[model samples]
Target: IAVMTVLLIVVGLTACGKSTAQDLQSNKWYPNQKGQSYKTQFNKKTMIIESPLMNVNANYSVSNTSGKEYLKVNTDDEKNQKLELTQISDGYKAKAINKPAKADDGLGSFE
Candidate 1:
């Protein structure tokens, strides 16, 4: 009886731990798909953004309506900004509605 109980517990745990490829694929979020969206909040001041084929960490909210995707970012030191990304044949094109102010801070660099 003890051996059978242990075997049953082990089997149950193993089953719970195993995830098939189909299960993994189903859980993945595809941003390019119409009506499909995702949101990630890192903290009160930071968030992780995901669009059809892009990902960025910022203080923003992302949404899609009528097959159009939009990204809105807000910062304490800067004015609120919004951008629209349109899916093209090859990739996405971004158009900013209100251009953000440039900062000389060395937070980012170009190689």
Candidate 2:
């Protein structure tokens, strides 16, 4: 009698778990679109010469331009820059605008 009771309890729990999972899967959550803009700040001091060592503030905006969707990122720092990324098949792609030239290692080869 105890073994039968334990088996019934286990079966009930399994059914409850499956039902909860299905309910969660049927309901999808999406972000709010009421002109919401996300902002982020970063301050870092790096020993590596390749990395930037400064305080930076970035703002992200999502909107549609000319019927195409884009994610815009604006940064305020030494190199004040703006980037607009467009969604591609595999990932996003953005053109490098107003970028500085690569430094040469004095041997005509880029470092």
Candidate 3:
């Protein structure tokens, strides 16, 4: 019974898709800063980021640790832009995950 239940749960989760992806995809992520004109779209294995600072197609992966979601982005110009993002009342709170750089600067609860 326990094994069946676990299998069912796993199957359901897989069929529904990863919650992190769904949550990330539901909203059009953008920088909170005004006048910057930034828009980001998250897909299964990639994302499109458009802003004055950078405009490029990037590959990304979502992972959860300690109940926190971290997004890793890799662009042609940059690699492994990791960010620990938490959903806030207004937007999202984000910070550098590992080695900080310009790529991780684009995330936060600014708007």
Root-mean-square deviation (CA) per prediction: 14.6, 18.0, 4.6
Superior candidate under TM-score, 1 versus 3: 3
Choose 1 or 3, whichever is better by lDDT.
Answer: 3
From the highest TM-score down, the ranking of the candidates is: 3, 1, 2
Best-fitting candidate, scored by TM-score: 3
The list of candidate 1 runs beyond 4 A from truth reads 1-57, 89-91, 99-111
The number of the candidate with the highest lDDT is: 3
TM-score of each: 0.34, 0.29, 0.64
On residues 1-111, what C-alpha lDDT tens digit does candidate 3 reach at each position? 999999999998887874767777787877555455478787878788786766678888878888888877777766777877777785665566565334444332233
**Clashing pairs in model 3?**
32-111
lDDT of 1 by residue, 62-106 (tens): 566796766556655444566675555543444565546224211
lDDT of 2 by residue, 1-111 (tens): 999999999999986763322322343322112332222221221111111343333444444568654333343322323234454444344333333211121101010
- Candidate closer to the true structure by TM-score (higher is better), 1 or 2: 1
Relative to the true structure, how large is the alpha-carbon lDDT of every model?
Answer: 0.48, 0.34, 0.70
Worst ten in a row by lDDT for model 2: 102-111
Off by over 4 Å in 2: 1-57, 78-81, 96-111
